[model samples]
Target: MITVVGTGTGAPLSPDAGAALAGAGLVVGGRRHLAAATTMPDTAERVVLGPLAPALDAIEQYLEKPADQGRVVVLASGDPGFFGIVRALAERFGADRLAVHPGVSSVATAFARLGLTWDDAVVVSAHGRALRTAVNVCRAHPKVAVLTGPGSGPAELGAALRSSGRVLVVASALGAGADSGTGSGASTGTGTGTAPDSGSASQSGERVERVTPAEAAARDWGPAVSVVLCLDESRVLSPVRTIAGPPPGPAQWALDEGEFTHRDSMITKFEVRALALARLGPRLGEHVWDIGAGSGSVAVECARLGAAVTAVEKTLDGVERVRANAAAHGVDVTAVHGAAPTVLSDLPDPDAVFIGGGGRELPAIVTACARRARRSVVVAMAALDRVPAVRDALVAAGLDCDGVLLQSSRLAPLPGDVTRLAATNPVFLLWGVRPPARDEGVAQ
Candidate 1:
């Protein structure tokens, strides 16, 4: 049977795990883990994991040996089941053929070192994956724990959060060199309790430091980092959560225009926003850009729907309005005080984009957004003259273009006490979705 053991930080193996290791014919782990395993049987075959395929092959081959002879033990960091190696092992060898011995996860150890409870915090992993979504989560949530990897570690995360008013509690190398016999990993300089030391900011040893986003962005944090906790002290202990992690999406969207603070009726109406949001399909773990955000109503609504949102507006007043709207709704939106088509170059490519106001540069903005959007782009225009050009821009970018005209009427009471239908100005809504890529010469 294959046994998976969690070596939690630097904690020593438990008695049962130790017995398992003693009887193991094959032991597989990282170089650090293998080096720390002094109790492993001298005759045990060792496999240092670099590329996982070879070790998986060894496990499969050894499992095929005579019954009761091949005892394979795999050592993993923290809890193996928590975004760890357990999933891979379970998929390969049936769950029935394996036993799991879990230790504390790195997230748990990091939080413990900080003396904080994380039920209200959102936990995301940047290990071998994109850091954009993690950065977005930090923007939207008050407390976030990011599991760091080689390229997406603290320095990268800190730079992204710069000037965002969030503080980063960087925990590095938790339990790096501490003797497992004492049941404590390395000591974080703070003597708060029994929690092990998360590593130092320097690559040489273990340490923990809490710094503002701007401060974190300016420093050089070594590569030995483990996890970084992004927090907004103002909301640290949020209203006691009945459920864990980020709260559920807002009960309803397409809120009325009166909900936001706008100047000169610059916000998109609820009627149009509903349709545009439907086409955009904002949801968790996705990024949406609202170019030419007037009151940022669309961006705020998207953020409320659980997508990471960036609102780009040129005017200083418009930028302030967007920030205010996002704050009123209690969601995070990165409001850029710059014009689109020029500012769009530095922002990460979006999953979806909504162009609400771009004046004469509408076509260029639509082209830029459509080319980079992974899913769809939606544009709202009041000027009839711009419709054909916007549609053509999306079409030329290889998107399937669609459009509709929306005209709504509200019942208003006249002076005579009779109701009349007051028609609102008509607007043309245009949207496009990139068609799936096809092989050469394939039929449409």
Candidate 2:
């Protein structure tokens, strides 16, 4: 039988897990993972898995030789089922061929130490890649915990967040050096509080505290073992009971033109913006580009609705305003300082695109939007002359184009104890969607 064990750094072997590893004759794992299997009989062969490709090749070679030669033990960190080596091994050898064991995950211990609930937390890893992906999530999600690695460790994440005017909490070495070590090999990403600190973030911090990687390894963290980051630390409202999850209240999107802090007459009218946003349909798991985002009301609103949003605002003033608005609403929106259609090249392909400030560039911007957007594009225009040209651009891109003339009036109290129709302004909304390929259409 093949047994998998989690060798949590600072904690003792769990009863069941110890039993499994004790019976193994051959053990393979990362250098750190091998610690738990070290106490096995001297006759057992110990192998270190690394550089992944070579390690996997060696395992396959051994499995091909014989089964009864010896029982094999594979060691993993944290919950092996999660982004762990178990994925690689299971894929090659098949699930039925293995008997698994588990431990607590980093996310759980981190949150537990902070006395926070992780059900709503967005957990991501920046172990080997650039920290951009995790940074983006922190920009967007209120409660996020990022698993850090060598390059993208605590300090890097902290610096990125500090520059963005966001506050964060970092925990390191959660299962190591702590009396309550991390649980990594578990099947689930949760942990039960067995000691006094169990289950409550309040008490958990006492048993397993949070620290930066530097602090944990610095001889100062006492017994802390891992990092748990809170993106918006300044806003953690002390009697912080509720999740404050998914924004504090209702959405007040599509605000009037005058609502934004813009100087040079660059605002999308309320009516037109409403139509543009409807066609765009922003939400979580998708990306939207608010090109020429003036005050960033649309981009901010989309982010609050859970979409990963990027706002390309050319002017420094507009970028600042967008940042302020995004923070005020408690949503993460990236207000990039650049011109778009030109600047759009580096970003991930957008699911939706909105052009509110692009003038004669509307057509080209629309074309670019069509190419980059997987679903739809929406453009706003005040000049009647630009409408047809923009519409034609959409049609030429092979999209079903549609346009709307938006004229809205707010009821105002008149001086003579009466109500009046306060006509705001006239604007146009142009939306388009690409027709599915004829040959590749879904078969009925």
Candidate 3:
């Protein structure tokens, strides 16, 4: 059987792992892990893991030997099962053929160094994945842990979050001497509670440096960086929770018009908002644009649904109303006071967009949003004349357009202790979706 041992998080090798290494016919691990393990017998063939497939092949070769020949052992950083090599090994050589030993994960070590609890933090990996997803997560959530890879390290992350008002805790060289070398192992990134002291070093040679997003972007934090914690200092410590991750999204969405502070009955009705939300599919690690956000109802709801939202309004009072509604709902939304089609140029690309009130510039706004939108775009219009132009704009941008004319009636109390069905105005809700293949190819 192949023995998988977790190491490199300042944890000593367990007796079983040590014995397995000593008796191994073949050993596979990173250079640091192999050098740190002094107990391995001289007869064991060492394969320094650079590319994964080659190492798996070597392990397979060793396994093919008879029972008396010897065993194979693989050393990895932290718990091999938690986004580690165990899955790869198990896929190549069946789980029953391996004995695994786990160690302290870098995420736990980084949070421990900060003297904070992480049961509420969102953890995402930028390892061999698009960095935009991690950036979006950092923008949407108050606390986040990012597992860094080559191109997705601290500098890249910081550059993306420079304007996001987040503090980054860069932890490097976990469980090593003061002069440790760097490797391409797992790096845990997250946001934590308590103000960072900055420039703190642990006895194990782990350097935990705290810097603002701008500062982090300015410097090159070498490959030794094990983890990064992105935090909003204002809301670092959340209330006690029963579940983990992102607080389980909002329990209720498509809030009533009365729930928001709007001027002169100028908010998206709950019925229309519900359908728009369904088409938008806002969630963690996504960005949404609410154009012509009069009362900012749609923007606030998108933020509440766990998406990074930017609300655009032409009037100053409308901008304030958007901000106020967002504050009232306890969510973050970037309220931009400017006309659509023009203001949207500066903002980041959105996964989905909701265009509320664009008058003469409705088609231009829809075209701008649909062209940049990675997934879909939803447009709500009260005037029937704008419907055809909006649909044409969506189609011009290579989107599959679909729409509905909604007419609803709600119960209204009458003077004689009775209720009457009050018919509301009709609205045209139009949405355009990009093809899946095109969405996957989007750079942002």
Candidate 4:
């Protein structure tokens, strides 16, 4: 059997792990892990993991030996099952053939050091993945723990969140390291892990630093960062939650037009909003844009569906209404007071976009949104003349364009409690989706 040990997070090997290590014929781990393994038998063949495939190959070769020859041991940090090497190993060698031992995750350790409970907090991994998903999650959620990697470390995360009003608690060298000092910035603390003594090598060099997004962006926090906690201090301590990870995408979406505050009854009808939302496909860890958001009905719905939404309005009153609507819905939405095509440049590119109003500038607005949208763009218009231009613009941006003219009639209360079919104004709903191959080519 291959014994997978989780260490490097202040937890020493258990008796079972030690016994397996002693009998290990092939030991696979990182350089630091191998160096710290004073108990590893000298007869064992060591494989320092560089690329994952080669280490997995070595393990496979060693597993072919007879059970009486020796067993295999793979050393990993924290919980091997949590975004670690266990998945890779299990894929190559069946899960039943291996034994996994877990330690406290870096996310858990970081939160523990701060006296914070993380059952309600969202945890995202930026290691070997796009930082945009982590950044977008941080932007939408109140508390999030980001596992840091080489290029997607604290500085990169901070740069993305500088204007997001988030406090970053960067935990560096959570277990053993060369230097045992505090991190740079405000509110620095040094503490040892759960070891018996202060000088224990396994628990030393753990430092936690709290800084603003701007502060975190300004420094080069060398290669020792374990996790970064992005928090909105105001909402750090959330009410006790029965469930975890983003509180389950609002019970219902496509909320009624009356739910939002708008002037002159100007709002996207529920039917159109429903189709727009379907085309947008907003979800957690993604960003969505609502351009010309008069009432922010679409934006609020997108936010309710668990996306980081930005609403751009030309009128100041419209912007205020958008913010108020988002507040009433208990979701986060950034309301920017400016016209579409122009203000969109200042905002980050979104995974999807919704255009509600633009008048004569509808084509230009659609062009801008289509070019920047990573996935899809949905446009709703009352004027039928704008459809051709918008389709042309989407086609110019290399998106597959499709549209439908929606004419719906709702049941209205007539005299004597009788119901009459009231015909609602027809709306043109158009959507453009980027091809999967093309979307993969873009920088996420």
TM-score of each prediction = 0.90, 0.64, 0.91, 0.91
lDDT of 1 by residue, 267-356 (tens): 899899999999999987788999999999999999998888999999998899999989999888999989879999999789999999
lDDT, residue 351, candidate 3:
97
Question: Considering TM-score, where higher is better, how would the candidates rank from best to worst?
Answer: 3, 4, 1, 2
lDDT of 2: 0.68
How much lDDT does each candidate structure score? 0.84, 0.68, 0.85, 0.84
Assess candidate 4 and give its lDDT. Answer: 0.84
Question: In lDDT terms, which candidate is top?
Answer: 3
Query: Of the candidates numbered 2 and 3, which has the greater lDDT value?
Result: 3
Clashing residue pairs in candidate 4 (N, C-alpha, C atoms within 3 angstroms): none
Winner by lDDT between candidate 3 and candidate 1: 3
Q: List the residue pairs that clash in candidate 3.
A: 144-190, 145-189, 145-190, 146-189, 187-226, 188-227, 189-228, 190-228, 190-229, 190-230
lDDT tens string, model 3, 1-444? Answer: 889998887767778887888888888998878887777888888999989989988877777788777788888888889888999998988999879998888788788878888888898889889998899989888888888889998889998888888898888777764111222233333333232322233323566677888777777666677778898878878899899888887889999999999999989999999999999999888999999899999999999889999899999999999989998988888889898898888998999999999899999999999999999999999999999999999999999999999999999999989999999999999999998773667795
Cα TM-score of candidate 1: 0.90
Clashing pairs in 1: 172-199, 186-197, 187-197, 188-197, 199-206, 199-207, 200-206, 200-207
Off by over 4 Å in 2: 61-68, 128-130, 149-162, 168-172, 177-230, 237-288, 292-295, 308-329, 334-352, 360-377, 387-444
Lowest lDDT sum, 10 consecutive residues, model 4, at: 178-187
Give the clash total for candidate 2: 27
